[model samples]
Target: MDVDTRHWIGGRRVANADTFEDVSPLDGEVIAVVSRGGTAEVDAAVAAAKDAFVGWSRTSPAERAELLRRVAAGIEARIEDLAQVETRDNGSLLRSHRRGVMPRVAMNIRFFADHLSSLVHSDFDTRGHRNHVTWDPAGVTAIVTPWNAPLMLATWRIGPALAAGNTVVAKPPEWAPLTASLFADIAHEAGLPAGVFNVVQGLGNEAGAPLVAHPDVRRICFTGSVPTSIKVGESAARNVTPVSFELGGKSPLLVFDDADLDLAVDLAVEQFDNSGQVCLAAVRMLVQDGIYDEFRARFLERAATLVQGDSRDEGVDLGPLVSKSHFERVDGFVKRAVAGGAEVILGGGPNDELNVATGGFYYRPTVFEGVDRTMEITCQEVFGPVLTLQGFSTEDDGIAMANDTDYGLAATIVTGSQERAERVASAVRAGTVWVNCFFVRDLSAPFGGSGRSGIGREGGTWSFDFYCDVKNSVFAPKGWN
Candidate 1:
């Protein structure tokens, strides 16, 4: 695919001295040559954004919302093409992109656009004083997005920043950098002001570090793994910039003895979505002892039937890992787990059988049965199509086991009783909890993580709160109106 994978600054593509090949996970071939950004590129993008922030920050909420609406329209108008590219770029299911993700990307922007103008900013009287709260737009924001679900995640941060009237410089993951350039083109065509939205593509240390640590960057948003988040946090700390992170997860999926067996089994299988690359998927399952054997039997039967192949195939259920290195990392984790006394109940590893037939990083859906919280596989985020099973006896045991992990991003509870669902959902220390369901999201609800999983929330008013400065102006009550 011929794409302009260059740094976008001030509404134009900026050329670079160094370049990197963007490999397609679909077939392990070079799809595009992306311009590699360095500190210089980051500096240029930041300068552009800082210059644009003056006018953007001064714009009325209505005007910013209208522009965001246009950006949403532009994205939807070319949703098919966007989905196709994302599939080839990220090695995810095209059907999923066409049906769900791409639509949500546009909606992510549209929701913020429509709601920013109707925000609940009100003035109230207290002690003969009328006080009005204001959401003031921050200056330039640095957004570093991950390779998995790049477009969706980037827009999740970008939409709110733009709607809040903050100019942005996004450093997209070099592994899946194509669509970010495409997104920049759409924004420019939608008539977004120059430098309001910029894309700088390169290695983390070279480009990402400079962008996040830039003194002029007022806000930083990062979404990636735990180790990488530490680096980002350190860089942002130097500038004392406010940052928000959506990091790794070892989230738990709980099944009570009284849970509907069919529902529990189905939800357990859904964890393999995106080849278990999803951060929000609860891959570590803690099941009640009474129904443990039955759940395992049903889960194994369904998991074995999952067809792994190239993502371009229409009926294929699983796709390759995002890259060669990621596949090795996941495979190594499985091997180590098996050696450490965890029994592989199902798939152990791919023997390169699928990759032999087709070129790419392919692994079978794997499950380990004899898993314990003491094991690294149970505690660490493998970020693969690997599930670890551990049986718990009582409700307290299940909750304790679920909360054992250092990460608290998301969790799932599958149960028959409403009381149990409500109780467990409340007790679980996660940013988002689903009862008898998975991946069902409402845009208005607050979405973020706790502990090592992340720092702040970014949905609806939570997003505005992150990208804006909340202030109150006091006035004389009688003369204010």
Candidate 2:
């Protein structure tokens, strides 16, 4: 927890006039103070990246793969420290962070290292003539990553963008910029060239906006809320720069009568894993009418038993919501749900275990019954440890309730029969559907949304296609020419 007001530009850290403090969501503690960058630092980062793009983009794919391999090694070596920092900064549970954060980030790095060269060198031939398609990096990329899953999300964008030969100006959330600073040092050890990858620290209006709006930036990859995605999309449009966004979700989880009650309950907690901050967290639970009461009983039993406390506490399964503002926002939604006639089935209070004088954004993992599809809690994205429960009498009704919301980022259908699982999974409108399991993701599987959830996809080996353009090269016989 150090306060250093500087940014990585042209391969090294540089100072800025203004500063911002990074506060720990666990205890509302000032963990670090990062310097805010203005037009000068953003321009410098862009210029440096443009300068580096020439050689970096021209480097062989094998060489790029080797660099990515080293970056993976550096991250592996410091996995413990990185996981702890992510938990502290994002208020994710320590155990979950360790399990979910490290392995995934390393896997992304390794996945790209192993497959990027092949993806880049892959060629296509059509009609007995040579027609080739190559993947090239977009020249200067502005990566605007969210505070949630800082390192991992950055790797998702930066890894592929860099692997394809783009130089980058990565801007992490201003609330947790220090981790990206740490990551930059890790990259330095990984042998990335000066300006090949840079981290600029500042707020969206100052640093993020300029970076996105910069004329030299050819592409953008962002992960955050929908409103911000719209802004980034607008900037990209004005500049004619292609952009990718991994945005918000009001995902659903369906439980059928045949599902194992124990398993369904466990997955219910997983839906709120990280206190339900994940973009694709299963915020809505749709249970078949036959088992609605039983499912509710089991869900409340498990949810009531969960331990919510400081990230530093042992056996703490859930931590605080990000900050006071986030806490207020989530709490406000819960209040609205209650006012709208949803019954609080379980857990509706603040945790008193942590420092109470200055409450860290802590709230009980809440569940609501009597939820109608039209209610705000059921229809909107309540990015908190809050789950709204709705009962459906038939299979079609279950699907109808699951797809009721405008957001369709992800959903889960639990059933003992494969036919039923597939049937419901097909009917549910979402980018990802978990069959009998919830929140389980494969790095090689496509991840995105179906509706207002998001615009672009991430994850999977072939995900680079969403971020790059494809062109066909044709050859004719010399005699014909």
Candidate 3:
């Protein structure tokens, strides 16, 4: 398909004077020439959103829900096309994008639409005075989504922000902007009003900075790294604009002696599903002393079975990293880990043996043993197909080790005993804890992290709250009046 790589502003594709090549990581080929927008483009998008907010914020909930449903239908109809674009742009496996990510994008839109009615205002009486609480749209919201899982994360922010009657100025990562632009097309086809949704395509320093620092933007929602989020937060702080961050993670997966060994091993291997590019992946595995040896053997056996090849190839379990730089960064982590006294037990470098038409950015699924909690390998967010295994003596020791990191995005407890599961789940400092499962998400559940992982939450009512402002009104009694 011939894609018009341009910025989507005010319901139209706008071209910038300068452009950059959208390189496909799969084969290191230039896929498209994307417009390189800057502060001017961001200003235009924000102005458009502000102008549309007057009408959009006044629309009734039912009307907004209808438009969202239409958007969801449009996405569902073009899932295959979007999946292909995403696979090419982000280096994700075509099968995973088609069967996993694209469906969630559609589901996110529909889920927020169906749950709109639940964002209710409260009425109560306090000392014979009637009090009512209400919600209002928080002006123009600037949503900056990351390259990994581009469309899905974009929809995660857009669905709730739009459902709450807010206008949006979105900045999709420069590396993977095609699917996001396609999503804007789908929204326009679904009858989204001009400027209600706008996308500014450019590098973060040029376009994203202006959007976050814009005085007209009331809320800033960002999904990316911790260091970047700190800068975003500082920029928004100058204007006192509310900002929501879904940052990185060094999340842990704890396996107790009594756990379902097979299930634990399966989840441990599945951590490399998206080439370990997932923010919520279980990169740190903390196993109990009694079963650590056995678990390590089983996990290695499973990890060795992963098929690393071209994303478009069928039965390929792992795809290339997002870019050459990322591939190198992951490799550097492995080298450093080994130098730091960690043992590389399995595949630890790029896979060059795959038969492909052209050169691609590929890495083998790497596993490290004898990883201490304080080691850089165990503490840092590798953001690759690198897993670090550590052993713990007791349940308390396991929980302590799990919460030792600076990140608290997610964690999982695998065990047969419900009491043990609950105990560990409650003790872990992470935001979302999985019991006997991993990456099993529900739209209604609150998702986000504590401490350095992020601030605030996304999903369901929490999302609605973040995207809106609450105001309360009180009525006086007749005698008092």
Q: Rate the local accuracy (lDDT) of all candidates.
A: 0.91, 0.81, 0.90
For lDDT, the strongest prediction is 1
After superposition, the stretches of candidate 3 with alpha carbons farther than 4 Å from their true spots are: 355-357, 479-481
Roughly what TM-score does model 2 have, to 2 decimal places?
Answer: 0.95
Model 1 misplaced stretches (Cα beyond 4 Å): 477-481
TM-score rank, highest first?
1, 3, 2
Q: What lDDT score is found at residue 461 in candidate 2?
A: 50
lDDT of 1 by residue, 409-481 (tens): 9999989899998899999999999999999998889999988999999888999999999899998746533
State model 3's lDDT: 0.90
Tell me the tens digit of each residue's lDDT in model 2 across 295-388: 8887887777787787766788788888787888988998888888889987765566554854588888888988787788877777888887
Where does the lowest 10-residue lDDT sum fall in candidate 3? 350-359
Greater lDDT among 1 and 3 belongs to 1
- Candidate 1 to truth, TM: 0.98
